[model samples]
Target: MFTNKGKDVVEGSSSASATDHRQQKQASQPAPLSRYESQKRRDWNTFGQYLRNQRPPVALSQSNSNHVLDFLRYLDQFGKTKVHLQGCVFFGQPEPPGPCTCPLRQAWGSLDALIGRLRAAYEENGGLPETNPFASGAIRVYLREVRDSQAKARGIPYKKKKKKRKLMKANLDNNPNISLQQS
Candidate 1:
Protein backbone atom coordinates (compact mmCIF):
# COMPACT_ATOMS: atom_id res chain seq x y z
CA MET A 1 0.00 0.00 0.00
CA PHE A 2 2.90 2.36 0.74
CA THR A 3 4.66 1.85 -2.62
CA ASN A 4 1.72 3.13 -4.75
CA LYS A 5 2.32 6.88 -4.33
CA GLY A 6 1.34 7.81 -7.91
CA LYS A 7 0.11 4.59 -9.56
CA ASP A 8 -3.00 4.27 -7.36
CA VAL A 9 -5.55 6.70 -5.98
CA VAL A 10 -7.25 3.95 -4.02
CA GLU A 11 -8.44 3.93 -0.40
CA GLY A 12 -5.68 5.03 2.02
CA SER A 13 -5.61 4.68 5.78
CA SER A 14 -1.87 5.33 6.15
CA SER A 15 -0.30 7.87 8.48
CA ALA A 16 1.30 9.66 5.45
CA SER A 17 -1.77 12.03 5.56
CA ALA A 18 -4.15 12.94 2.71
CA THR A 19 -2.61 16.39 2.00
CA ASP A 20 0.90 14.94 1.95
CA HIS A 21 -0.12 12.30 -0.60
CA ARG A 22 -1.44 15.02 -2.96
CA GLN A 23 1.72 17.12 -2.59
CA GLN A 24 4.04 14.19 -3.41
CA LYS A 25 2.24 13.64 -6.76
CA GLN A 26 2.38 17.25 -7.86
CA ALA A 27 5.29 18.77 -9.79
CA SER A 28 7.35 21.79 -8.72
CA GLN A 29 5.34 24.98 -9.22
CA PRO A 30 6.23 28.59 -9.94
CA ALA A 31 7.01 30.97 -7.06
CA PRO A 32 4.15 32.82 -5.39
CA LEU A 33 3.59 36.51 -6.11
CA SER A 34 5.26 39.17 -3.93
CA ARG A 35 3.21 41.93 -2.23
CA TYR A 36 4.31 44.47 -4.86
CA GLU A 37 3.21 42.18 -7.67
CA SER A 38 -0.15 41.53 -6.00
CA GLN A 39 -0.75 45.25 -5.52
CA LYS A 40 0.21 45.94 -9.13
CA ARG A 41 -2.29 43.36 -10.35
CA ARG A 42 -5.06 44.83 -8.20
CA ASP A 43 -4.27 48.38 -9.36
CA TRP A 44 -4.23 47.28 -12.98
CA ASN A 45 -7.61 45.58 -12.63
CA THR A 46 -9.05 48.68 -10.95
CA PHE A 47 -7.79 51.00 -13.69
CA GLY A 48 -9.25 48.65 -16.31
CA GLN A 49 -12.59 48.76 -14.50
CA TYR A 50 -12.48 52.56 -14.46
CA LEU A 51 -11.84 52.59 -18.19
CA ARG A 52 -14.79 50.31 -18.76
CA ASN A 53 -17.06 52.69 -16.85
CA GLN A 54 -16.25 55.64 -19.09
CA ARG A 55 -18.84 56.87 -21.60
CA PRO A 56 -18.75 54.60 -24.69
CA PRO A 57 -15.92 52.85 -22.76
CA VAL A 58 -12.23 53.48 -23.41
CA ALA A 59 -9.76 50.78 -24.37
CA LEU A 60 -6.39 50.52 -22.62
CA SER A 61 -4.58 51.18 -25.93
CA GLN A 62 -6.48 54.45 -26.46
CA SER A 63 -6.44 55.80 -22.88
CA ASN A 64 -4.20 58.79 -22.17
CA SER A 65 -3.07 61.07 -19.31
CA ASN A 66 -6.34 63.04 -19.39
CA HIS A 67 -8.30 59.89 -18.58
CA VAL A 68 -5.87 59.04 -15.82
CA LEU A 69 -6.27 62.51 -14.35
CA ASP A 70 -10.05 62.21 -14.53
CA PHE A 71 -9.89 58.82 -12.81
CA LEU A 72 -7.80 60.31 -9.98
CA ARG A 73 -10.31 63.11 -9.56
CA TYR A 74 -13.20 60.62 -9.59
CA LEU A 75 -11.48 58.71 -6.76
CA ASP A 76 -11.44 61.90 -4.66
CA GLN A 77 -15.16 61.39 -3.95
CA PHE A 78 -14.42 58.15 -2.06
CA GLY A 79 -11.45 59.48 -0.07
CA LYS A 80 -11.23 59.45 3.74
CA THR A 81 -9.00 62.47 4.32
CA LYS A 82 -10.59 65.84 4.89
CA VAL A 83 -9.20 68.24 2.31
CA HIS A 84 -10.84 71.64 2.63
CA LEU A 85 -11.60 73.86 -0.36
CA GLN A 86 -10.12 77.36 -0.65
CA GLY A 87 -13.46 78.82 0.39
CA CYS A 88 -13.59 76.75 3.57
CA VAL A 89 -12.73 78.49 6.82
CA PHE A 90 -10.49 75.58 7.88
CA PHE A 91 -8.56 75.64 4.60
CA GLY A 92 -5.11 76.07 6.18
CA GLN A 93 -5.75 74.60 9.60
CA PRO A 94 -3.74 71.53 10.57
CA GLU A 95 -6.76 70.39 12.63
CA PRO A 96 -10.07 72.15 12.91
CA PRO A 97 -11.62 72.23 16.37
CA GLY A 98 -14.94 71.16 14.91
CA PRO A 99 -15.97 69.38 11.76
CA CYS A 100 -17.34 71.67 9.08
CA THR A 101 -19.00 71.24 5.68
CA CYS A 102 -15.69 70.39 4.03
CA PRO A 103 -15.64 67.25 1.94
CA LEU A 104 -13.26 64.39 2.66
CA ARG A 105 -10.82 63.52 -0.10
CA GLN A 106 -7.83 61.23 -0.72
CA ALA A 107 -4.43 62.36 0.43
CA TRP A 108 -1.80 63.37 -2.11
CA GLY A 109 0.55 60.71 -0.71
CA SER A 110 -2.01 57.97 -1.36
CA LEU A 111 -2.62 59.17 -4.92
CA ASP A 112 1.13 59.31 -5.60
CA ALA A 113 1.62 55.78 -4.26
CA LEU A 114 -1.31 54.50 -6.34
CA ILE A 115 0.24 56.03 -9.49
CA GLY A 116 3.57 54.28 -8.84
CA ARG A 117 1.85 50.89 -8.56
CA LEU A 118 -0.29 51.53 -11.65
CA ARG A 119 2.74 52.67 -13.68
CA ALA A 120 4.60 49.42 -12.93
CA ALA A 121 1.48 47.38 -13.66
CA TYR A 122 1.03 49.15 -17.01
CA GLU A 123 4.49 48.12 -18.21
CA GLU A 124 4.12 44.63 -16.79
CA ASN A 125 0.86 44.25 -18.72
CA GLY A 126 2.65 45.00 -22.08
CA GLY A 127 2.19 48.76 -22.13
CA LEU A 128 5.01 50.84 -23.63
CA PRO A 129 6.66 52.84 -20.82
CA GLU A 130 6.98 55.95 -23.00
CA THR A 131 3.29 55.80 -23.87
CA ASN A 132 2.10 54.93 -20.35
CA PRO A 133 -0.49 57.43 -19.09
CA PHE A 134 0.62 56.89 -15.49
CA ALA A 135 4.18 57.86 -16.49
CA SER A 136 3.12 60.98 -18.45
CA GLY A 137 4.29 64.52 -17.69
CA ALA A 138 0.69 65.62 -17.11
CA ILE A 139 0.19 63.04 -14.37
CA ARG A 140 3.49 64.12 -12.76
CA VAL A 141 2.51 67.79 -12.75
CA TYR A 142 -0.94 66.94 -11.38
CA LEU A 143 0.64 64.93 -8.55
CA ARG A 144 2.96 67.81 -7.71
CA GLU A 145 0.00 70.18 -7.62
CA VAL A 146 -1.93 67.83 -5.34
CA ARG A 147 1.05 67.54 -3.00
CA ASP A 148 1.46 71.32 -2.82
CA SER A 149 -2.25 71.92 -2.30
CA GLN A 150 -2.59 69.23 0.39
CA ALA A 151 0.48 70.50 2.21
CA LYS A 152 -0.84 74.05 2.19
CA ALA A 153 -4.28 72.94 3.39
CA ARG A 154 -2.73 70.92 6.22
CA GLY A 155 -0.39 73.78 7.17
CA ILE A 156 2.70 71.63 6.57
CA PRO A 157 5.23 71.88 3.75
CA TYR A 158 5.80 68.70 1.77
CA LYS A 159 9.52 68.25 1.07
CA LYS A 160 11.22 65.38 -0.76
CA LYS A 161 14.35 64.42 1.17
CA LYS A 162 17.38 63.95 -1.07
CA LYS A 163 19.48 60.80 -0.76
CA LYS A 164 22.89 61.35 0.87
CA ARG A 165 25.97 60.70 -1.28
CA LYS A 166 28.65 58.27 -0.17
CA LEU A 167 32.31 59.38 -0.62
CA MET A 168 34.36 56.67 -2.39
CA LYS A 169 37.89 55.91 -1.18
CA ALA A 170 39.11 55.53 -4.82
CA ASN A 171 38.28 59.20 -5.52
CA LEU A 172 39.95 60.36 -2.24
CA ASP A 173 43.17 58.49 -3.15
CA ASN A 174 43.19 60.13 -6.61
CA ASN A 175 42.91 63.65 -5.15
CA PRO A 176 45.99 65.26 -3.46
CA ASN A 177 44.08 67.87 -1.39
CA ILE A 178 42.04 65.37 0.62
CA SER A 179 43.88 63.11 3.08
CA LEU A 180 42.67 60.54 5.62
CA GLN A 181 43.74 61.52 9.17
CA GLN A 182 44.26 58.98 11.95
CA SER A 183 43.51 60.74 15.25
Candidate 2:
Protein backbone atom coordinates (compact mmCIF):
# COMPACT_ATOMS: atom_id res chain seq x y z
CA MET A 1 0.00 0.00 0.00
CA PHE A 2 2.84 2.39 0.93
CA THR A 3 4.65 1.61 -2.33
CA ASN A 4 1.52 2.34 -4.41
CA LYS A 5 1.00 5.62 -2.50
CA GLY A 6 4.62 6.64 -3.10
CA LYS A 7 4.22 5.83 -6.86
CA ASP A 8 1.07 7.99 -7.03
CA VAL A 9 2.91 10.92 -5.39
CA VAL A 10 5.78 10.59 -7.83
CA GLU A 11 3.39 10.62 -10.83
CA GLY A 12 1.57 13.68 -9.48
CA SER A 13 4.83 15.56 -8.95
CA SER A 14 6.08 14.68 -12.41
CA SER A 15 2.85 15.92 -14.04
CA ALA A 16 3.01 19.16 -11.99
CA SER A 17 6.62 19.73 -13.07
CA ALA A 18 5.66 19.20 -16.73
CA THR A 19 2.94 21.81 -16.42
CA ASP A 20 5.38 24.18 -14.71
CA HIS A 21 7.91 23.74 -17.52
CA ARG A 22 5.32 24.51 -20.19
CA GLN A 23 4.25 27.65 -18.32
CA GLN A 24 7.88 28.76 -17.96
CA LYS A 25 8.52 28.29 -21.68
CA GLN A 26 5.45 30.30 -22.58
CA ALA A 27 6.50 33.11 -20.23
CA SER A 28 10.10 33.25 -21.49
CA GLN A 29 9.33 33.79 -25.18
CA PRO A 30 8.73 37.42 -26.36
CA ALA A 31 6.28 38.17 -29.17
CA PRO A 32 8.27 39.42 -32.20
CA LEU A 33 7.09 41.99 -34.76
CA SER A 34 6.68 40.94 -38.38
CA ARG A 35 9.52 41.56 -40.94
CA TYR A 36 9.66 45.15 -42.27
CA GLU A 37 6.48 45.29 -40.19
CA SER A 38 6.51 48.93 -39.12
CA GLN A 39 7.14 50.35 -42.59
CA LYS A 40 4.58 47.95 -44.06
CA ARG A 41 1.99 49.03 -41.51
CA ARG A 42 2.63 52.71 -42.29
CA ASP A 43 2.45 52.19 -46.06
CA TRP A 44 -0.83 50.25 -45.75
CA ASN A 45 -2.30 52.92 -43.48
CA THR A 46 -1.28 55.68 -45.89
CA PHE A 47 -2.74 53.79 -48.85
CA GLY A 48 -5.89 53.14 -46.84
CA GLN A 49 -6.21 56.87 -46.19
CA TYR A 50 -5.68 57.64 -49.88
CA LEU A 51 -8.38 55.15 -50.83
CA ARG A 52 -10.77 56.69 -48.32
CA ASN A 53 -10.26 60.12 -49.86
CA GLN A 54 -10.78 58.93 -53.45
CA ARG A 55 -13.88 59.95 -55.47
CA PRO A 56 -15.35 56.43 -55.26
CA PRO A 57 -14.23 54.51 -52.23
CA VAL A 58 -11.83 51.63 -52.85
CA ALA A 59 -10.64 48.85 -50.53
CA LEU A 60 -6.92 48.64 -49.81
CA SER A 61 -6.68 45.00 -50.92
CA GLN A 62 -8.64 45.77 -54.07
CA SER A 63 -5.95 48.12 -55.44
CA ASN A 64 -4.58 47.29 -58.90
CA SER A 65 -1.31 48.15 -60.66
CA ASN A 66 -2.71 51.44 -61.94
CA HIS A 67 -3.70 52.47 -58.44
CA VAL A 68 -0.27 51.53 -57.11
CA LEU A 69 1.45 53.51 -59.85
CA ASP A 70 -0.82 56.47 -59.22
CA PHE A 71 0.01 56.28 -55.50
CA LEU A 72 3.73 56.44 -56.36
CA ARG A 73 3.14 59.41 -58.63
CA TYR A 74 1.21 61.10 -55.85
CA LEU A 75 4.16 60.56 -53.51
CA ASP A 76 6.47 62.11 -56.11
CA GLN A 77 4.43 65.31 -55.88
CA PHE A 78 5.78 66.01 -52.37
CA GLY A 79 9.16 64.24 -52.53
CA LYS A 80 12.30 66.38 -52.20
CA THR A 81 14.86 65.90 -54.93
CA LYS A 82 18.65 66.33 -54.60
CA VAL A 83 18.47 69.87 -55.99
CA HIS A 84 16.01 70.84 -53.25
CA LEU A 85 18.34 69.39 -50.61
CA GLN A 86 21.28 71.36 -51.96
CA GLY A 87 19.45 74.72 -51.64
CA CYS A 88 18.06 74.25 -48.14
CA VAL A 89 20.23 74.98 -45.09
CA PHE A 90 18.20 74.10 -41.98
CA PHE A 91 20.48 76.02 -39.58
CA GLY A 92 20.21 79.39 -41.38
CA GLN A 93 18.35 82.19 -39.56
CA PRO A 94 15.24 83.03 -41.63
CA GLU A 95 15.21 80.37 -44.33
CA PRO A 96 16.22 81.65 -47.77
CA PRO A 97 13.30 82.73 -49.94
CA GLY A 98 12.61 80.66 -53.06
CA PRO A 99 14.47 77.74 -51.49
CA CYS A 100 13.36 75.14 -54.03
CA THR A 101 9.64 75.98 -53.93
CA CYS A 102 9.00 73.43 -56.66
CA PRO A 103 7.52 70.11 -55.47
CA LEU A 104 10.19 67.40 -55.52
CA ARG A 105 10.16 64.35 -57.76
CA GLN A 106 10.80 60.84 -56.37
CA ALA A 107 14.15 59.28 -57.30
CA TRP A 108 14.31 55.77 -58.72
CA GLY A 109 16.05 54.35 -55.64
CA SER A 110 13.48 55.73 -53.18
CA LEU A 111 10.54 54.44 -55.22
CA ASP A 112 12.14 51.00 -55.53
CA ALA A 113 12.68 50.78 -51.75
CA LEU A 114 9.09 51.89 -51.10
CA ILE A 115 7.73 49.23 -53.45
CA GLY A 116 9.80 46.52 -51.73
CA ARG A 117 8.40 47.58 -48.33
CA LEU A 118 4.87 47.60 -49.72
CA ARG A 119 5.33 44.09 -51.13
CA ALA A 120 6.48 42.79 -47.75
CA ALA A 121 3.55 44.53 -46.07
CA TYR A 122 1.07 42.95 -48.48
CA GLU A 123 2.38 39.43 -47.76
CA GLU A 124 2.34 40.07 -44.01
CA ASN A 125 -1.31 41.16 -44.23
CA GLY A 126 -2.32 37.67 -45.48
CA GLY A 127 -1.83 38.30 -49.20
CA LEU A 128 -0.09 35.27 -50.75
CA PRO A 129 3.45 35.90 -52.03
CA GLU A 130 2.71 34.22 -55.37
CA THR A 131 -0.40 36.30 -56.02
CA ASN A 132 0.87 39.56 -54.47
CA PRO A 133 -0.16 42.53 -56.64
CA PHE A 134 2.94 44.48 -55.56
CA ALA A 135 5.13 41.57 -56.73
CA SER A 136 3.54 41.54 -60.20
CA GLY A 137 5.81 41.86 -63.25
CA ALA A 138 3.52 44.59 -64.60
CA ILE A 139 4.25 46.74 -61.53
CA ARG A 140 8.01 46.26 -61.92
CA VAL A 141 7.90 47.11 -65.64
CA TYR A 142 5.78 50.16 -64.96
CA LEU A 143 8.23 51.38 -62.32
CA ARG A 144 11.13 50.91 -64.73
CA GLU A 145 9.34 52.91 -67.41
CA VAL A 146 8.52 55.62 -64.92
CA ARG A 147 12.12 55.84 -63.73
CA ASP A 148 13.46 55.98 -67.26
CA SER A 149 10.98 58.69 -68.29
CA GLN A 150 11.67 60.72 -65.15
CA ALA A 151 15.41 60.52 -65.70
CA LYS A 152 15.03 61.62 -69.31
CA ALA A 153 12.74 64.48 -68.35
CA ARG A 154 15.23 65.68 -65.71
CA GLY A 155 18.19 65.30 -68.15
CA ILE A 156 19.83 62.85 -65.74
CA PRO A 157 21.61 59.72 -66.96
CA TYR A 158 19.38 56.65 -66.60
CA LYS A 159 22.26 54.17 -66.98
CA LYS A 160 23.73 52.52 -63.89
CA LYS A 161 27.33 53.36 -62.87
CA LYS A 162 29.92 51.20 -64.61
CA LYS A 163 32.60 49.55 -62.45
CA LYS A 164 36.05 51.06 -63.01
CA ARG A 165 38.64 48.52 -64.25
CA LYS A 166 41.65 48.16 -61.93
CA LEU A 167 45.01 48.30 -63.82
CA MET A 168 47.35 45.63 -62.48
CA LYS A 169 51.15 46.18 -62.01
CA ALA A 170 51.79 43.25 -64.42
CA ASN A 171 49.84 45.05 -67.19
CA LEU A 172 51.83 48.24 -66.56
CA ASP A 173 55.14 46.27 -66.70
CA ASN A 174 54.05 44.66 -70.01
CA ASN A 175 53.40 48.12 -71.56
CA PRO A 176 56.36 50.38 -70.63
CA ASN A 177 54.75 53.21 -72.66
CA ILE A 178 51.80 53.39 -70.21
CA SER A 179 52.38 56.00 -67.40
CA LEU A 180 50.21 57.03 -64.39
CA GLN A 181 49.29 60.74 -64.29
CA GLN A 182 48.75 62.47 -60.92
CA SER A 183 45.57 64.51 -60.95
Candidate 3:
Protein backbone atom coordinates (compact mmCIF):
# COMPACT_ATOMS: atom_id res chain seq x y z
CA MET A 1 0.00 0.00 0.00
CA PHE A 2 1.12 3.59 -0.71
CA THR A 3 1.90 6.08 2.04
CA ASN A 4 1.62 9.92 2.18
CA LYS A 5 4.94 11.84 2.43
CA GLY A 6 4.10 14.63 4.94
CA LYS A 7 2.07 16.59 2.34
CA ASP A 8 -0.60 14.83 0.25
CA VAL A 9 1.86 13.25 -2.22
CA VAL A 10 1.86 9.52 -3.01
CA GLU A 11 4.92 7.52 -1.87
CA GLY A 12 6.15 4.03 -0.83
CA SER A 13 4.77 2.25 2.27
CA SER A 14 7.53 3.08 4.82
CA SER A 15 7.60 6.71 6.00
CA ALA A 16 11.40 6.86 5.52
CA SER A 17 11.02 5.34 2.04
CA ALA A 18 8.25 7.80 1.22
CA THR A 19 10.41 10.76 2.26
CA ASP A 20 13.31 9.41 0.13
CA HIS A 21 11.05 9.07 -2.93
CA ARG A 22 9.79 12.62 -2.49
CA GLN A 23 13.34 13.89 -2.20
CA GLN A 24 14.36 11.91 -5.33
CA LYS A 25 11.48 13.40 -7.32
CA GLN A 26 12.38 16.90 -6.20
CA ALA A 27 16.02 16.32 -7.11
CA SER A 28 15.08 14.83 -10.51
CA GLN A 29 13.00 17.86 -11.43
CA PRO A 30 14.98 20.26 -13.66
CA ALA A 31 16.17 23.60 -12.14
CA PRO A 32 14.12 26.58 -13.45
CA LEU A 33 17.17 28.17 -15.12
CA SER A 34 16.88 29.15 -18.79
CA ARG A 35 19.72 29.35 -21.37
CA TYR A 36 19.76 33.16 -21.13
CA GLU A 37 19.92 32.93 -17.35
CA SER A 38 22.84 30.52 -17.48
CA GLN A 39 24.69 32.71 -20.02
CA LYS A 40 24.09 35.80 -17.88
CA ARG A 41 25.58 34.01 -14.87
CA ARG A 42 28.70 33.10 -16.88
CA ASP A 43 29.01 36.63 -18.23
CA TRP A 44 28.70 38.05 -14.72
CA ASN A 45 31.49 35.75 -13.50
CA THR A 46 33.80 36.81 -16.36
CA PHE A 47 33.03 40.49 -15.83
CA GLY A 48 33.76 40.07 -12.12
CA GLN A 49 37.16 38.67 -13.01
CA TYR A 50 37.91 41.69 -15.19
CA LEU A 51 36.80 44.10 -12.46
CA ARG A 52 39.06 42.27 -10.00
CA ASN A 53 42.12 42.94 -12.27
CA GLN A 54 42.21 39.58 -14.08
CA ARG A 55 42.46 40.61 -17.72
CA PRO A 56 42.39 38.36 -20.75
CA PRO A 57 45.51 37.86 -22.86
CA VAL A 58 46.33 40.48 -25.46
CA ALA A 59 48.39 39.87 -28.59
CA LEU A 60 50.67 42.77 -29.62
CA SER A 61 52.89 43.57 -32.60
CA GLN A 62 56.32 45.20 -32.26
CA SER A 63 56.77 46.68 -35.70
CA ASN A 64 58.06 50.17 -34.84
CA SER A 65 60.48 51.37 -32.14
CA ASN A 66 58.32 54.48 -31.67
CA HIS A 67 55.33 52.21 -31.14
CA VAL A 68 57.12 50.43 -28.32
CA LEU A 69 58.03 53.71 -26.60
CA ASP A 70 54.51 55.02 -27.07
CA PHE A 71 53.11 51.86 -25.46
CA LEU A 72 55.33 52.43 -22.44
CA ARG A 73 54.24 56.09 -22.34
CA TYR A 74 50.60 55.05 -22.50
CA LEU A 75 51.08 52.67 -19.59
CA ASP A 76 52.82 55.37 -17.58
CA GLN A 77 50.06 57.89 -18.31
CA PHE A 78 47.21 55.59 -17.41
CA GLY A 79 47.54 53.14 -14.52
CA LYS A 80 45.50 50.24 -15.93
CA THR A 81 45.41 47.73 -18.78
CA LYS A 82 42.52 49.50 -20.46
CA VAL A 83 43.02 53.24 -20.93
CA HIS A 84 39.88 55.26 -20.78
CA LEU A 85 38.36 55.43 -24.30
CA GLN A 86 39.65 58.89 -25.18
CA GLY A 87 39.84 60.23 -28.75
CA CYS A 88 43.50 61.34 -28.57
CA VAL A 89 44.81 57.97 -27.31
CA PHE A 90 42.56 56.05 -29.74
CA PHE A 91 44.04 57.78 -32.78
CA GLY A 92 47.56 57.87 -31.25
CA GLN A 93 48.11 54.08 -30.97
CA PRO A 94 46.70 50.68 -30.02
CA GLU A 95 48.17 49.01 -26.90
CA PRO A 96 50.53 46.22 -25.71
CA PRO A 97 53.87 45.94 -27.48
CA GLY A 98 57.23 44.32 -26.70
CA PRO A 99 57.53 42.91 -23.13
CA CYS A 100 55.10 45.36 -21.54
CA THR A 101 51.49 44.33 -20.80
CA CYS A 102 49.74 46.06 -17.87
CA PRO A 103 49.72 49.79 -17.18
CA LEU A 104 52.40 51.30 -14.93
CA ARG A 105 52.93 54.38 -12.79
CA GLN A 106 54.10 57.41 -14.73
CA ALA A 107 57.88 57.45 -15.04
CA TRP A 108 58.33 61.03 -13.79
CA GLY A 109 62.08 60.76 -14.09
CA SER A 110 61.74 59.93 -17.78
CA LEU A 111 59.96 63.23 -18.50
CA ASP A 112 63.22 65.15 -18.79
CA ALA A 113 64.68 62.55 -21.16
CA LEU A 114 61.53 62.51 -23.26
CA ILE A 115 61.51 66.31 -23.51
CA GLY A 116 65.23 66.38 -24.31
CA ARG A 117 64.85 63.78 -27.03
CA LEU A 118 61.94 65.71 -28.49
CA ARG A 119 63.99 68.91 -28.50
CA ALA A 120 66.97 67.15 -30.10
CA ALA A 121 64.79 65.62 -32.80
CA TYR A 122 63.28 69.02 -33.53
CA GLU A 123 66.74 70.59 -33.68
CA GLU A 124 67.85 67.89 -36.12
CA ASN A 125 64.70 68.05 -38.20
CA GLY A 126 62.63 71.21 -38.76
CA GLY A 127 59.99 70.66 -36.06
CA LEU A 128 56.41 69.59 -35.43
CA PRO A 129 53.44 71.95 -35.63
CA GLU A 130 52.60 74.29 -32.73
CA THR A 131 49.26 72.48 -32.31
CA ASN A 132 51.23 69.64 -30.73
CA PRO A 133 51.54 70.56 -27.03
CA PHE A 134 54.72 68.50 -27.02
CA ALA A 135 56.25 70.93 -29.56
CA SER A 136 57.79 73.14 -26.81
CA GLY A 137 59.85 76.02 -28.37
CA ALA A 138 60.29 73.74 -31.39
CA ILE A 139 57.65 75.67 -33.33
CA ARG A 140 59.46 79.01 -33.02
CA VAL A 141 62.81 77.33 -33.59
CA TYR A 142 61.44 75.61 -36.69
CA LEU A 143 60.14 78.90 -38.06
CA ARG A 144 63.55 80.43 -37.49
CA GLU A 145 65.18 77.50 -39.28
CA VAL A 146 62.75 77.82 -42.18
CA ARG A 147 63.50 81.54 -42.43
CA ASP A 148 67.24 80.86 -42.31
CA SER A 149 66.97 78.13 -44.96
CA GLN A 150 64.97 80.44 -47.20
CA ALA A 151 67.54 83.22 -46.74
CA LYS A 152 70.38 80.81 -47.54
CA ALA A 153 68.62 79.40 -50.61
CA ARG A 154 67.90 82.89 -51.97
CA GLY A 155 71.40 84.15 -51.15
CA ILE A 156 69.76 86.97 -49.14
CA PRO A 157 70.94 88.38 -45.81
CA TYR A 158 68.60 88.56 -42.79
CA LYS A 159 69.31 90.61 -39.68
CA LYS A 160 67.71 90.17 -36.26
CA LYS A 161 66.43 93.54 -34.97
CA LYS A 162 66.27 94.06 -31.23
CA LYS A 163 63.33 96.19 -30.17
CA LYS A 164 64.10 97.88 -26.88
CA ARG A 165 61.15 98.97 -24.79
CA LYS A 166 62.04 102.07 -22.78
CA LEU A 167 61.13 101.20 -19.22
CA MET A 168 59.92 104.10 -17.06
CA LYS A 169 62.42 102.64 -14.63
CA ALA A 170 61.20 102.86 -11.08
CA ASN A 171 63.51 104.79 -8.72
CA LEU A 172 62.97 102.36 -5.90
CA ASP A 173 65.96 103.95 -4.02
CA ASN A 174 63.92 107.18 -3.69
CA ASN A 175 60.85 107.28 -1.44
CA PRO A 176 57.82 105.59 -3.16
CA ASN A 177 55.65 108.38 -1.63
CA ILE A 178 57.63 111.02 -3.66
CA SER A 179 55.74 112.05 -6.81
CA LEU A 180 57.36 111.32 -10.25
CA GLN A 181 56.45 114.96 -11.25
CA GLN A 182 58.84 116.21 -8.52
CA SER A 183 61.65 114.21 -10.22
For 3-25, candidate 2 gives per-residue lDDT tens digits of: 56446446677779999999999
All candidates' TM-scores? 0.76, 0.54, 0.20
Which stretches in model 2 have alpha-carbon errors above 4 Å?
Answer: 1-36, 82-103, 153-156, 160-183
All-Cα superposition RMSD per candidate: 6.8, 10.6, 23.4
Query: Against the hidden true structure, what lDDT does model 3 obtain?
Result: 0.41
- For residues 1-183, write the lDDT of model 3, one tens digit per residue: 543455564434467897899999999999887765554454334323433442333222111223323433443555433322223233223332333233344333343344344444433334344423234464345345534543443344568886442333345335466444542
Q: 2 or 3: which has the higher lDDT?
A: 2
Model 1 weakest lDDT span, ten residues long = 1-10
lDDT of each: 0.86, 0.71, 0.41
When 1 and 3 are scored with TM-score, the better candidate is: 1
Q: What order do you get sorting by TM-score, best first? A: 1, 2, 3
Error of 3 at 178 (Å): 16
lDDT for each residue of candidate 1 in 86-140, tens digit (9 for 90 to 100): 8888889898888888788888889999999999888888899889999999999
